[model samples]
Target chain A: MDTCIEKIRTICADLLAKGKVQKVIGFAEGSIPMASRPIAVTSKEDVAKLVFNATCGLNLANYVSDVLPKEGKIAVTAKGCDSRNLVTHMVENQVSRDQLYIIGVPCTGMVDKRKIAALFEDEITDFIEDGDTLTIVSPQKKEKVSKKDVLRHNCRVCTHRNPVVFDVMAAEPVEEQSLDQPFADVDHIAAMDPAARWAHFQELTKNCIRCYACRNACPLCYCPTCFVDESSPQWVGKGQDKTDINTFHFLRAFHCAGRCTDCGACVEACPMGINVRDFTRKLNKDALELFGWEAGLDMEKRPPLDVYSPDDPNDFIK
Target chain B: MNFITIDKKDWTTGIDKSRETYQVFGPVQDENGCQIKPLAPDVHPLMDAGVTVMSPKSVLFPQTQKMLTATLDASIEDHHVMKPVKKDDTPRVVLGIRPYDARAILLVKLNFDNPDYQDPYWCEAYAATTFVGLGVNHPGPCDFSTSTGCGPFSEEGLDVLMADLDDRYLAKILTEKGETWAGACGFDTRADAAESQSLFDILRKEAEKNITSVDTDQLSEKSILDLYEAPFWDDVAFSCINCGTCTFVCPTCWCFDIQDETKHKTAVRFRNWDTCMSPLFTHHASGHNPRGSKVQRVRQRFMHKLKYFVDKYDQGIMCVGCGRCVASCPVNIDIREVCTIMNNYESK
Candidate 1:
């Protein structure tokens, strides 16, 4: 972790000093335990704030549109999913390939803080990651646990552990896992009857307060005015009616369609601990199954949902 | 004020007895985490749920509250006119509300229960509930409530303040409403006043020692324009995604928007929680949004909480620093960092 951060800081600082890029987007140590914040550093001094760990779960690709450089380029540190989203961004004209200096970081899976916190009876005061061991410190006890135990649900099943595109590599790529059932969670919901599936989705979204953290955190959700916020036409109700909540989630998921990278940014950003990927992951699986396609892997290829073909699947429509 | 010894063995019975008259709401462990929800007949409060991510304000000010109802049918008498929705008016006991959250309810009240105009929905709900606060023995690391006009043990808006004494609870009744609730619970065993006072003081001091403080002295002296035009906001607002997570989780965030929804012939006016982070919060009817940019929306949140609120109310910052936003923020936009920047800004 230390070596990775040192190399990242050096590259970012060098980029800033040489005026190669106006800014270097990276992860900084967060105020809380087992968390890191997305940051943009413009100076060599600010590069000291840069750090990397399993906690850097929120996708850095989401910030590229907001921090796009008008002149030279903006250097963004992209993990596997983030690098994919960056490719998507280039494909979608959100940013040109020339306008970005992608600093690719080979990623280890991010740990779920909720999982770590639940183990201790008291509040967790400190989290130290060394090698493959995670030391969780609390008022009650200080215990070292294997990092594999606390990996986030999305990270546990992640196939892309290395960035597909990069200007410079932060470290050697970690070995990727090949899961037999990548969409097992989706399959569990699919196996249920239509009424039971509806109930499951309804129960899942019953706690949604409509904060839109899930929407905003998504790299794909870059619409100037989200459908939920469109008052002139008002596609969905602003209040917490069950039907309104379901409509908002369903529409937002549909919009992501073939473009979702299974990045888990939406889950990481949600305050309610809502597994919104349930809505989008189903689309991700369908895209892969029907179109034999994965999102953000290629800059030249358009998403299946973005373009229409006469040969497109019509079974679901009927 | 009176102190009562709530024996651990009697706690469940007392709560069950109190529920016969009032709906009991408290921190109950859900599948996700601890939330202050209506306690089912089988459920009991998690005495040390810590600071709930969602606030207790929803007890009095619901996230989506129906304010008015009307019918579109022209033939019916008193139709097509918005009429006040019949309120339940049932008394509720917000059991084990944190002292800071209790104080937050009063901060919200300043907006809804003002002299100029009172919101009947919020005010009537507030009038009906009993606020029973629980003092924190071990404050969380993010909690800076000590410096933000509230402390772990502060009792500004509570009807009764209870202290967790390991084996049992020592409840101090401070109002007639609290006394009535206690009586209903059969919590009549009294503790000596002086002894309980000394214990509370010691606990409060110990908890305060654990918390970090902020400096806001310069904020009162600085002009609104100086803080507004300060150069630090762009960097502060950079990572903000303009999501309402921080505002919605915040106990002190009291903004709401009213909308009338109609189905068939019936219309219902509902007020839902709103946030300064949304572009539509300041959007004009002519499609001119004053705070259109993400930076502008982010700036509004901090300015309102730290500067405008202080200048308007002559009170401390609108934040109690319960640290819900600090813990819940996805991008890690720390309020402590922003508050410090605003507090000590030497505006150019």
Candidate 2:
């Protein structure tokens, strides 16, 4: 861990001096103990604030599009799943590849904040990491737990142990993890009868206040103009009716069918804790089986719904 | 204009064979009534004229995407990285699209691809997909697009237009893409210019006649702008839960917010769709919200649709009047009723 911290400081100082990047956006040791938050380092003096440990679980890729320097180059670090998001962005034309310097890190997964908080009833004063185990020292008690016990749902099915697209590699690239049981939950839902399925959907959708946190957390939903705002013809209404709620979820699920990467960000971002993952995972399975496609895996491949083959089958249209 | 008549039996085979060359997408049935599914040998029968529970906008702009990725550790060598993805331009076909939806796609093209505004993601998807619009033989419960001047068939962005003329379906080849698609169907009879004109006239008359008797002239862009502070918003928005359902279901709402997700040394930045109806829709990081209340959010939804969009897009009425909101609203707040109320209020 000490060696990793030293390496980060040396590289940041060198990058700033060489003019390779104007700014480096990374995590700094937060003022509060055990809390790691996003920080931007412009000069070598700020390098000492950088830290990477078990508690550093927030995906920093979310900040790059907003903070990265446009004229000069910018440098950022990434973990296995984080690299996939970069690949997804490159695939969707959100940011330019030439303007970025990627430092890929092999991850052993990170802890979920909600789970950690639930475990520690009191506020954590300090935290220490020893290999894969995290020891939390709170004002009242000290607790030690394996990082695997509190891993986020996203890290469980992580396929890309190595950065799919990166410039400079930091740690030794880990082998891809198996995701054979990825759709088990979706399959279980699919096994239910139509009435049961509808009941389940209705129950889940009824809880939707239509905050669109699911939509906002998604990476592929980058439309400058969306259909819900059209007024000339007013395709849909502007009230909180059950039918309207159904339409919102139904359309949202369909729209995300082939494009959803199943990062679980939508589920995590939901304040109501609705099972939005079921819909996305179901669509993911459909896209994989029907179109033989997987989103966020290959940057070169086109989304299944976007392009068509002349020999494409359409026996269902009759 | 080119028209061809195929027996109902031959129609399926012709379309099936023609679809073989293009990636085909159309409506399909799930546990729900209907949705636009990928066209396949087993699912082609799902293309009948029925209102899909969901719109086809997903074919262009998706719900989630990764915009960029980064690493926070500076000493890890290569740090901040930006990677942009390219959109696919493969030719495909959308079969069994209602006239209003076909028109809606055209509107999307106009709004998304304007010189002043360009949405590359939508453009790429639209460019790749050929629209094979199927005219509605029966308008469903919620379809009010015909009243708004969008009807059975539109040449706005169609590759091929198929209209059900009683027993036989008239296949009109509109664009060069449609002509090429028609050529692949092994039917050589070209639709003459006269036939095309007659078809247009018939469609226009039918649409105008079916339109709901609403005085939209009074609800112009000017009137909508003036009504921003009207008490009607409070009355109408009373039932609104600020769930963003209207913006999500409407075929034209298009606001978004960007966020970052980071873990360990890595980070990813992405954009997701947002709606004006939510309290946080216009909330900035500084804790100030532009559209803070239900009334403001609701007002913004209608104002953007009726006034702002039209003001920006040159009389471009963003709403296609699909009435999905009317059917879906839990409070049963029909947009048509709201428009009528607004029209009446302006009159007095």
Error of 2 at B264 (Å): 6.4
Q: Which residue pairs in candidate 1 have backbone atoms (N, alpha carbon, C) closer than 3 angstroms, thus clashing?
A: none
The TM-score of predicted model 1 comes to 0.98
Model 2, span B1-348: residue lDDT tens: 467654565666766777667777888755323567567765574555356655676666554455567778898667876555544667777777767777777666676788788877777777778777776554544556754556655555577777766565667777887777766656565556677568756865664554454444455535654578676776566434344556655666656666555669878766666777656567576867787666787778777766666667664467777765654442345677666665566523
Stretches of candidate 2 exceeding 4 Å from the true structure? A1-318, B67-79, B185-210, B221-225, B262-268
Overall local distance difference test of candidate 1: 0.89
Q: Output the number of the DockQ-best candidate.
A: 1
Candidate 2 lands at a TM-score of: 0.52
- TM-score of chain A, model number 2: 0.82
DockQ of each: 0.80, 0.03
Supply the DockQ value of model 1: 0.80
TM-score of each: 0.98, 0.52
Our model 1 lands, by Cα RMSD against the true structure, at 1.3
Question: Candidate 2: lDDT of A271?
Answer: 42
At residue B283, give the lDDT of candidate 1. 93
